[model samples]
Target chain A: MTTSTPLQPVVQARGLVKRYGRVTALDHADFDLMPGEILAVIGDNGAGKTTLIKALTGAITPDQGEIRLDGKPVRFTSPMQAREAGIETVYQNLALSPALSIADNMFLGREIEKTGVLGSLFRMLDRAQMRKEARAALTRLGLMTIQNIDQPVETLSGGQRQGVAIARAATFGRHVVIMDEPTAALGVKESRRVLDLILDVKKSGLPVVLISHNMPHVFEIADRIHIHRLGRRHAVVRPSDVTMSDAVAIMTGAMEPPAQAA
Target chain B: MSTDQPSSAPRGPQAFEKVLPENEAPVRFEAERESGIKRFQNLLHSHPTAIPGIVLVASLVFFSVMVGGRFLHPFNFSLIVQQVMIIGIVGIAQTLVVLTAGIDLSVGAIMVLSSMVMGRLAVEMGVPTPLAIAAGIGIAALCGFANGVLVTRFRLPPFIVTLGTWNIFFALNLWYSASETIRAQDIEASAPLLIFFGQAVELFGARLTYGSIAMLAMVAIAWYVLNRTAWGRHVHAVGDDIESARLAGIRTDRVLLMVYVVAGVICGIAAWALIGRIGSASPQAGQTANLDSITAVVIGGTSLFGGRGSIVGTLLGALIVGVFRNGLALSGVNVLWQEFAVGVLIIVAVAIDQWLRRTSR
Candidate 1:
């Protein structure tokens, strides 16, 4: 058997432990996400995949863990700190304002202001410039079906809203884009569009962390699957080696873990 | 492309196809046909000032036709402006609170209380006129900050907080003013600055007060801030969906607190206008100002639900009330009937707002 030497993980977690009173959410969990690869994390209910992501994204500080980004140990105490470090998370609820236009929603917190007196003296937003950039971002993602960039988000269909959310994450994300349930709330066609957008994100040179329950989707897109069980990494297996049932069985703890972790 | 399958290593191209999705299909869908009413709703929703603007014009036409040349005269038009000046100023403050999905029922009390402080400090306590005025406006802003704190820190609903503070401020006004109206002559003698806004400028047969012109300027400044600035967008975003705003990194509590403080400052200015308009500082003054201001905001097409509406619409709304009352009275309508007409307009305006809001869903 020929084995290729693997590059160091872009984001790595080791010995993560979190306790909520008497409950142990994460017990010495270890995680690895290699550079430029789609990594899928699958687990059953109460298996602590969320806790693991929270620890990695700085939403919560684990009681014990060392997180490394690009081989440098870092500590983040807030989501903003994580975001500043080139990690953008597309939350499941999307966090979009319905009454605001697409451009306004896209530039909600970090708005582009006009230059000179209009911007500094009057504190005016550069609406035209923001609209232009918003259009460019949408076009880059091939999301041109939305003709009016000024239309309110409530006017959009479910799939379109998801598309905008992904486009937002893609535009700002520098190194890693983490999506929690990107396709869980979508219809069949909407899910398909989301899957394509995910690949587009990867193709644009950003690694993606997809957390989902869709087995076929996991097998189809993920280069490697991280099966989590009992608050720790059970095994890392190549998608080409594990069958869907075997992945599910290992996740649910009905089968032994693979001998060789990918 | 790298493949993990050792057995399927020879099937290189097909192996890549197994993991990667097929070429994405172009997003295919046509725009849905919208009914005319829906389109109109969209138009009105985008430009909230249109309906109230139309209503103001329609009211003018209806009154002029019903009452002839007297109603259309510039003098009569100025009378309408003078009548609505207090409500117009107070309504600006109310519009700010309402735009945040909150209602300030204590605005009338705040204005009256601030005026009493201005009058008592200048005329009775012998403070400099400018200092008294500054103190009054400052006190009003402090009162507003208190409301903001109680709402944001305690996590209380604004309606409940303002409703409680309204009674507190009203009681405070009664105590501080000794339930007595400051006579206009004492203010005229001691502090002419107290009534500065009441001074009139005659132009083209129309007598316009400094207060009325100030109200106009205030409206313009407010419109610029709400439409042109980042803070204004955050205000809308916070009101529209607070959770989303917070997730987007807006400090929602601070935004909400600032909104209340700004509303209070506007109220203080309204108090100055009130003192000038009525020629006295009476705890009894502005008894109906709260409801009247609310009436103007609603009639102007600013949504009670917040995250929508404009100050221009609010100006038109205050005018609508003024014209309706003056026009109805000129046409010999009974006072009770004029009140009834205003009540009907309020209901209709709210109904239209509710209808307009439905298009978003």
Candidate 2:
């Protein structure tokens, strides 16, 4: 499907099995992401798209699976651990504290401490340094229109908030960035900004996993399309190989998925 | 993309444009020039502490103009500090809890329990004075930590957890103290340290007790912790939006537990101040302390819903209550009228809070 496919996948998940009593969410899902590609995961409702992504991002642990990061087997128990391994997620709800300032929310849990007794003894934060770094991160993402680093997230528009959330993920996601419905709640113009941000992030050389319901957005941006069906990854296809109607048919079990590498 | 025509909005995800209701779309675009009042609202909303600060200064000015020199005198101000010391101390605890979007209805009960522990242990059991006090504070912390455990581990709502513990801690206090008061003289004879906070130094025309000074210091320290530290920011984050805080990788349960435990420690200290202020350890005292602290926190511009407030604003809130009581009494207003005034202030403060919150959309 591509002129030159890379030998190594940036993130690889194999034999991922998750269950909740009688219902199985992710059933033996296998996935792969080549370097510097926007991999869009798409499926009909209840087709285990969310479960597969959650299992990958440490939002949920699989009953059975092997996940590899940079060719080393790894298991994650929490989002924090996943982040520690250089995986960042931008949740659908834009997981930013509304009342906290932009810098505070950016460095919410991993706040920088001052160098001396003010930090060691009294636990004072280095607000100036944090603000400077936050400004730099935003600038790196071409989001410097936000004039105030101390402005609370509540004060920002929906597009600006999404910008902040994506900026956060892009700034920290060294290995891969996984986003769940990042544009699900935004307006048309705001969604445009987010799609541009996804491209901008990819340009910085990190792979992206976009979980999207919008077919148009998918066909426009995704380098590889991972079709999930019946609780597992059905096929990994390129947009150039099929029409949108055939993809929908495969997604809903109306047609057989084309044989391809996943 | 496909060589075919690009899918337009009508062909994109069906749910995308459905959520674009006109009424709620303004959050995406609110850049128009604001009216005069809108500008003022924006100013007040940005600085959560300014409303209470202005109210305090205005009230002081009003009371001084009405009650003349006596209301503004240094001695009168010191008396106000003394009057609010216990509530002020507990108010600090209440602020911590309220900032986390929780309330401790058991703060008064916890304070009494700790004081009664000190009183009963030192006087009846003949425990060492310092040891008894330590035991009391420790028990107080245990009670607070218990509340934390129940709230976090059990995943119970904080209001309900504290409501149940309020009664549990109150019953424990009655059982420990036998529903009796330790006479001031008996405590004086056995443990002078119990009343150490009651001792005062004369400054000009004022008598500032150690408890009052400690209350002030506690305000300063709490302010420093809340404003200058990462833990403090996490507290705001968890309160502002716990789910977001968790998603952001903060140990939210741990933060909440710390909040409850620290609140418990403050209650223990307030118990010490309670003994000094009342000159006796009485189980019947502080029946209204829990509500009173809530009053201070609310009036201080801290939201009951959590994630927005200031510690210094709470101290000012306590002073606001103290000033109203002293000034109204001095003006020959009946005790009933004083309470009436406080009730009005509470409603107004809550109304203002609701107003400020509604504008965020």
Candidate 3:
């Protein structure tokens, strides 16, 4: 949680602005993520937390802003471009084909083909290899509760589906992972599992940007908290430096941000 | 403020085991212990063709009992095969589109129009039979391409797009053919190759036409493509959730376009089969084929909702229709009643689909 060391920011945004008609969604917002740190972005409803995340993930473009990844300026016009730039996002909906098998869902857009002539000529998928790899990836994440890799995703519980989405992001994400409301719909036990998953992802040495509403969950996992208020970043504080009530009060405009942290 | 525990304090396998163990084993066993009807519904959801296979067998037995041994006669069985071949072939095209949660109401029109192209090219233009056939299939593919473009680029619903195209293709068929019917005698005498499928092969005391065999072959190929290839998986993925597929970086528009184009080519092949079955290329034939092919797809256990269906199930669906018609005919049932029976089958199929979907959720 120390800011004394000069570690480079993996992803940095400045002067990010977006507007819908007269109402501004984001106004000169600034963000920073240190290497391998879990940065939790939190705010009340319509505080433009989603807008800021969307801008960063290339879901939407900001009117005026500069985003730098690894100190190099970048502009992403679409989600695909962001993905190609090594940014993976797990959406709240999970973005999975429910009727397809778990293995198929895992390999989805980036499928592996057969090695030799079969792949080149016929474009046949190596089903066995994909299944094995999918199982391995889930097991590595300690998500082996799923007994059958061939079962359709709809048959799985909410937690398992969330796990699958995270596993997908973890497998392909090279630089950074972004999760939008990862445990919003889950019960107590499921939320715990997802929290554990977020920690596991951070341990893999990839920085995670988690957008969540739960203060306790954020307090439990996040290294640093990015407080968003009134369509802009209000404060950036370490979890150890702020209590849950203070964070909530700062977000709700009940108390001013501590001068030192600001 | 109390300091929060380190995020990595509860890491690795032991932590996951503590969180996921309570309900996993119970849920699996509960699924296994469900009632017979629930299990049956589960089967229908997972393997859509199971009910169709059972229905086919049950109908065969029912017809055998109603008509005695005559229903099982080789001649009668082959007759049923011939009756189902046109719809069955077209059903392959329908199944492809349907797998992506699409419908091509113009499939029958495309088939008839393509056959007309083959007939006019061979007879009036004096083109060789093979070349004429190729022209017919090529035009069909182009028509399909147009449909795909309209659906994808214009963002039109498949139902509306195909419905409009159906009328357009039918009108084109009539205009191009000038309401002229190619005579069977001329086709047989001048271009015997066109009528080649009419030739019969005897196997195990039953007569099977090449046209019927072609239908089976198309089914097998469709099965292989849908089940074995990356493109096939893409079709399923697109049908299941287009938004998810797009997010996953699949070019959903391209997959949908390919599906439409492939469906059109298959329809053209059906056109060739149509010429072989009837010994002539008539724009008037297969008038009810559009509905018939859809009927076959639904009965075969392909979900109208898309993303979950099999081509083999479509073949069985087509056969189910054929069996019902022939069996009713043998029992001296009215023709109108036969149509009524098919209507009932469609509703039941959809009902089964809904029931199975409920269990999956």
* Candidate that scores best on DockQ: 2
DockQ of each: 0.38, 0.51, 0.37
User: Residue-wise lDDT of candidate 3 within B233-295, one digit each (tens)?
Assistant: 889999988899888878899999999999999999999889989888898998999999999
Model 3 CA lDDT for position A19: 99
Q: Point out the higher-scoring one by lDDT: 1 or 2.
A: 2
Sliding window of 10 residues with minimal summed lDDT for model 1 chain A: A1-10
lDDT at A241, model 3? 71
Runs with alpha carbons beyond 4 Å of true place in candidate 2 = A1-6, B1-30
Ranking by TM-score: 2, 3, 1
2 or 3, greater by TM-score: 2
Count of backbone collisions in candidate 3: 0
Summarize candidate 1's per-residue lDDT along B1-361 as a digit string, tens digits. Answer: 3333342213122343453344333333233556687789888888888999999999999998999988988989998999999889888888888888888998988888999999999999999999999999998998899899998999999999989999998999999999999999999999989999899999999999999999999999988888788888888888888887876767788989998898889889988888899898899998898899999999999889988888988899999999999999899888998899899999999999999877677
TM-score of each: 0.91, 0.94, 0.93
How well is each residue in B1-361 modelled by candidate 2, as lDDT tens digits? 3434323322333355455566555754665657788888989999888988898898899899889998878899899999988889999999999999999999999999999999989988999989989988999999999999999999999999999999999999999899999999999999989999999999999999999999999999999898889999999989999999999999999999999999999999888888899889999899898899999999999999999998888888988998898889999889999899899989999999999999985
Better of 2 and 3 by DockQ: 2
Q: Measured by TM-score, how close is model 1 to the native structure?
A: 0.91
Off by over 4 Å in 3: B1-33
Q: Listing candidates in order, what is each one's chain A TM-score?
A: 0.96, 0.96, 0.97
